[model samples]
Target: MKVLALKFENYRNLDDAIITPCDGVNVIYGDNAQGKTNLLEAFWMFCGGHSFRGSKDNELIGFGKPFAKLEVRFFGQDREQTASIKFKGNKKQVEINSVAKNSAAALIEKYCAVVFSPEHLNLIKRGPSERRKFIDSAICREKLKNAVVLSKYNRTLNQRNSLLKDIYRHPELEETLSIWDNSLLLNGAILIKQRMEYLQMLEKRAAEYHFGISGGKEQLEIRYLSTTNAEYGDSIEQIHQKLYETFEQSRADDIRNGCTTKGAHRDDAEILINGKNARLYASQGQQRSAVLSLKLAEAAVLSERMGEKPIILLDDVMSELDSKRQDFLLNKLDDCQVFITCCEQSNKEQLKHGKIFNVCNGVIS
Candidate 1:
């Protein structure tokens, strides 16, 4: 999809203004802390996700302002649509096409975007939770129903943990743990199956991208690490059986620990660069390249599943890349709408064709 216009009032550090972007590449350049990334964040909010920078609702409003308002008009699915968000005192309201929405997440079905911020480097630099979130988010975007399954999984996990804590004090209540375990087993198996399938598709596309970014000298591999010992080709039934056994095996330990110690929530994925774990051995550049590859692959997957390309947002991640890598991002992403934030004026000159918006102290021109 493409963003035709973004209107902002009392949002972050931005002055009240409307921005019209080109259909292809749009370069937003400015010095650090001048609201360059804020523009992209405004566009991303329409996708029904929290800020890429992890800002809270109250933090999104400009200082001395009581509220913030943002609106976007975009072309997608053979039509143009409008959406608006209003934030006041840590609460927000959303509307799409003049119809009120119960929550901002309702916009996910109407808009799509994939963002790559420097913070996303956590996918490799941090623990397994970050990697799991990356895979889960992509799956949710591809299949909205999976989002419900994921929510159920987390809820079941929390309930199970709470029961485990209570079981420590009252042995009679231990029987109810079985109920939560059954729900957890079913939901966890579904999650494992979906994650395995998504990673299989993602690894192929990411490998190709990593190959190009690394000049074909490095090979990228992604392997799912299921806590239930479920392999990549395991059927859903097989996965469910394994999860059942795992829950049985970990029951005592879970009760003693007062939380779950196994299942999908505890699983992870390994990112290998030429047979070595990127998290442990890859250089900063390699890690960044791997993240970029995975993000672009995510966009590719979304395009295939959605039948239309999702908008790409790149936030201040170019200076660390070499010319070859830079060329790939600037010239290789064809038929996709991209918004890139950079501090250097040279980045704008690198774009052969596109619109450029300069930001200075919250003003865009």
Candidate 2:
């Protein structure tokens, strides 16, 4: 996939900006807070209908503006695709090729992109939620059905928790807890299986890629630890039974804690290198390689699934790495379309061609 053109209106600091990026590697050079990252965010929003900065739809608008719009044109699967986003108040709408898309998720494959930023290092040092989100997003790209299962599981969990917290205040609601538990088991089991499938794929690819990225001295392993113990299988009956048993085992503690427990929400991924835990033992460089390997592995899988290379957005991250690491990073993008952001003052000599744009104070000049 390649983004041909992008335009933004009333988005954050960018009042009105338009860009035509080259197909290979386009570098956006500017100082900090000059909207270099915002350009990437605008492209990302049009591609996936999500922002890397985690800002809400309303927050995307400029300070005094009431609305924001991101218009993008790109090519995917050998055909041109265009999308537009218009946001006002708390409402947001998306259009694809001039036709309105009903759900943003429906536009996933059409606007597929994978982003890697400096903040991603937290995947190792941070909590389980971040790691789980990594797994969930990749799985979402692979299987849309997992979204349905995840939604139902989350809804059931919220209802179950609210019931637990309020049951004493209205004892009559206690009986409905069983209904929520059943729903959690059904959906949670599906979520667990999808997570295992994805983790196994990541582990297999990360091992080889990590060695290449790390010069073969370090080994990377991704271990998917389930909230409840159960191996991968096709039997929904067995999964449901195992989850039900887990819920029963945790029931007393959950009642006391006032939160639903024993589900994918509590799951985590452990990284090991050379028979030692990466989180506790890997050096800074090793942790960096682990994160990069996981991302590159995602690209490889997406390429295989779509039978075409996916667009990669590398956001001003190279400035943080040394020369050797930078070369390996460039090699990974050699076969794919990559949008790179860099500061002109930093070894801009090392970054190669596709298109070059200047961003200053939110204006692309």
Candidate 3:
């Protein structure tokens, strides 16, 4: 799938702009705070339901504007399609080819994309929550069912935690904890299984790519950690039994802790290079290399699953890379349409082939 064009009005600093991206390497470059990231953010919103900047939907609207309008034309599955999303005060809507969509999930799968930025390096360097989110977001994009499993797991976990809080004040709530525990086990186990499978695929892909980037000198490894070490611990049945036992074992502790402690909510994925923890040990260049490899791996994974490669959005990530890495990425981008925001002077030679959009004061010429 490819984004044919992106139309915007009242989005960030972009007042009214329409951009036609190139088939491979469309770079948008400018000085800091010049809306270079905003163009990439627009595409980020296209794939991620929320803004990559963590801004609220309404925040997408230009300051003082009542609403923001975004239209994306995508070529998908041998046909041209359009998706339009609008945001206002506490209101959001999505339309596909002028037909209203029922749920945001329905629209997300229509087009697939993956993004990488400086902030994304945090996935490896940050806490368990970030790592968990990394796996969850990537899995959620590939399979909508993963979202359902995650939602159910979170709801059950929340309810169970509340039950534990109640049990602390009233010992009579002991039995109720079991019911929530069982439910948590059932759903959490499903989530764990899904995540394990997803990570397994991602690890296989990331490892190969990382090896290539490292000139086969270092091996990349990803480890999935769960609550139990039992074989098939990721399986629902095994977890149900294990969770039942764990709850029985932690009956007194749960009452004291006032929260459910065992489940996928606490899961994490660890990245290792040459058997060393990448997050803590990797240098700046190594971190970038790891992230770059992971992103390319993601693209391969998506292509394998979707039977077609999703659109690639490079943003300004390439400019930060060394010439070799930049050239490597530029060469690998042959079959994919890449959209970039860059300054003309960065490399009139490298970007000579892309659709050059001169962005100035919220206008793209």
Candidate 4:
């Protein structure tokens, strides 16, 4: 997918701006706090109807302003399409080609974008929840239906937890917990199955990229840590049975703890370098390299699954990498559309071929 044009209004420091980017690499350069990241955030919202920076709708709106608006004209899947988002207070609306979408997942299904930021370098060193978010986000991009499934699973999990908390006070509610258990088992099984399958595919691609990035001196291994104890090759039925048994085994403990455990929500993705836990043993450089490998692998996997490349958004991550690593990343992204943000023209000589935009105090020139 290519973002042919982007327009923003009352978004952060950017009061009102429109930018038409190139089909290839587009470098957005400026000093700190100059709206470089805000522009990319707008593109991200265009593709997925939400911010990757974790800002809420109100935070995304300009200070002293009541609302924000973003619109994008893009070409994807062999045709041109327009996506627009209007944010007012806590509410937002999404439209594609002037037709409304029921949910953000609907917009994501039509257009997907993958983002890499400085925070992602910590993927190896962070907690399991961060890694899970990485995997789940990639899966949702590849199969939008999984996003809906995940939403339902989270809702069911919340309800089950609420019931578990209530059972502590009224043991009579214990019997009602079975209803939520069944829902969790059904949805959690599918989530576990999809995660396992996707991780298996990701491992092979990531290993290859890591091998090249590390000069074949390091080996990368990824495995899904399923709370259900289901193996990678297990069928959906087998996974469901395991999850049910797990919930049964953990029922008493869950009720006492006031939360449901032993489900997809508690699962993690284990990353190891040469059989050593990367989270514990990998150095800072190695961790960043591993993250780069994982992200490149994600782009490749998405491209293969969608029959086209997804827009790549790099949020000032290059400033964190060395020259060699930056070259590897830029070369890997040559076949796709890329939006890169930087503090200055450090890499201008290398990136001079692409379209360049300058940002200052929310204005782009």
Candidate 5:
């Protein structure tokens, strides 16, 4: 996928900005807080209907502005299309080709993007939630229905937690907890199954990429460690049975802790380098390499699944890598449309045949 053009109105500091990027690498260079990242965020929101930065719709609007609007025209799957997002107060709407989409998933089904930011470099060191987000996002890119599954699981988890709090307050409510338990088990089982399947594919591709990046000196492995110990080959019935049993086993702790203790929400992906925990043993360079490999694997998987490359957004991440690693990243992304944000102008020499846009104080020139 390639972004043909983008326009933003009242979006953060990028008011009335427009950019037409190149089909290859589009280098966006500017000083700090000059809206380079905001430009990438606009494209991300246009494609995904949400911010990778985790900002709410209201927070995405410029100060003193009542709303934010973004329009993007792109070519994907051999055809051109347009996507627009309008956010006002707490409400937002998405449109594709002038047709309104009922939900973000509908928009995502039409377009998909993958982003790598500074935060993603700490994937191995951060908590499990971040890793889960990475897996879930990749899964959603591959299959939009998985987004609905994840949303359903989260909602059920929240409802189950609320019931746990009620049970803590009124022990009599404990008898009624089975209702939420069944719902949680059903949704959580599906999530566990999907995550494991995707992780298997991701781990294979990531290991291959990591081995090449590490000069064949290290072997990377990723294991899906579910709260219920559900295996990848397990049937949904088997997973549901195990999850239901685990929920029953953790009832006492769940009630006392006022949370659902055993579910997909607590699942984790354990990354190991040569049979050692990467988080505990990997050096700084090793950690960055693992993240790079994971991200490249994500792009490869999406390309294979979608039959077209997803637009790659690199948000000020080149500054964190050395020249050699930077070269490797750029060389690996030869087939995808890339947008890279950097604060240094010297890096422009590395991008030989791409558009370079200058951004300053929300203005792009």
Candidate 6:
């Protein structure tokens, strides 16, 4: 998939502008806080709903502006397509090919892209939630229904937690807890099954990429460590049974803690480098490379599943990498459309084939 053109209005600090990017590498370079990353964020808006930077819908609008509008024309599914997003107040609307859609997630089926920001290195340097997010987001791209499943799971988990707090206070409301438990069991089991399936594919691909990145000197491994103690290859029914028994055993502890303790939300994936925890043992460079491997593997998996390469967005990540890794990103990834953001103009000379756009104070020229 490739972005043909992009138009923005009252979006973040960007001036109203339209960008026509090259089919290959497109570099957005400027000084810090000049809207280079905002340009990439505009491209990413087409991929899913919310900002990869975790900005709220209202936050996407420029100060003193009443609304924000983003539109893009892209080549996908054997033809050129157009999509747009409009944000007003706290509400946003989405449209594809001029057909109105209920939400921004509808764009996932229309456009697919993987992003790597500097914060993504936290996948290896931080705790398990980061890794869980990486897995879950990839799964959602591959299957849109998984997004609904994930949303429902979180909703049910919240309701159950609220009920847990009530049970602590009233003691008589404890009977109603089983209602949420059944919903949580079913949804959490399905989620655990889907996560394991995606992780199995990701683990192999990520390990292969990591090996190439490490010059075949180090080994990388990823395994799902379940909060419900569900084993790999367990059927949904088996998972549900295990979780049900666990919930029954943990009800007292959960009420005392005022939270749902044993479910998919509490699960984590263990990432290992050479049989050691990546979060604890991997060096800074190693962690970046590991995260890079996961991201590239995500792109590759999307390509295999979607039958087309997904666009890659690299936001201010090149400076953290060494020359070898930089070469791999700049010269090796020739098959996919890439939008890279950098603060240094010298980085432009490193590209073999691409167009460069300069941004200064929210203006792209």
Q: For each candidate in the order shown, give its overall lDDT on alpha carbons.
A: 0.90, 0.79, 0.75, 0.84, 0.84, 0.87
TM-score: model 5 vs. ground truth? 0.86
Residue 109 displacement (Å), model 6: 2.3
Q: What is the lDDT of residue 104 in candidate 6?
A: 88
Q: Estimate each model's TM-score.
A: 0.94, 0.87, 0.89, 0.88, 0.86, 0.88
lDDT of 2 by residue, 161-223 (tens): 989888757767778789888888888888887888778878888888888776777788888
Give the Å shift of residue 140 in candidate 1. Answer: 2.4
Highest lDDT: which candidate? 1
lDDT assessment of candidate 1: 0.90
Tell me, by TM-score, which candidate is best: 1
Error of 6 at 36 (Å): 0.9
lDDT of 4 at 129: 89
**Clashing pairs counted in every model:** 0, 0, 11, 0, 0, 0
> Distance from true position, residue 40, model 3, in Å?
1.1
**lDDT tens per residue, model 5, 23-141:** 88888888998999998888888665788888888998899998989888988868999888899986888899899887765776667777878888667888899899888878876
Ranking by TM-score: 1, 3, 6, 4, 2, 5
Better of 3 and 6 by TM-score: 3
Worst 10 residues of 2 by lDDT: 344-353
Candidate 6 Cα misplacement greater than 4 A, ranges: 61-68, 88-93, 100-102, 169-176
Cα lDDT of model 6 by residue, 200-286, tens digit: 888898898788777677788888999888988999999999999999999999999999888898889988899999889888878
Candidate 1 regions off by >4 Å? Answer: none
Q: State in Å the error of residue 174, model 1.
A: 3.8
Off by over 4 Å in 3: 102-104, 230-235, 341-353
**Model 3 agreement with the true structure over 269-337: per-residue lDDT tens digits:** 788888999988877767777887787778878888887787766655654555555655555567787
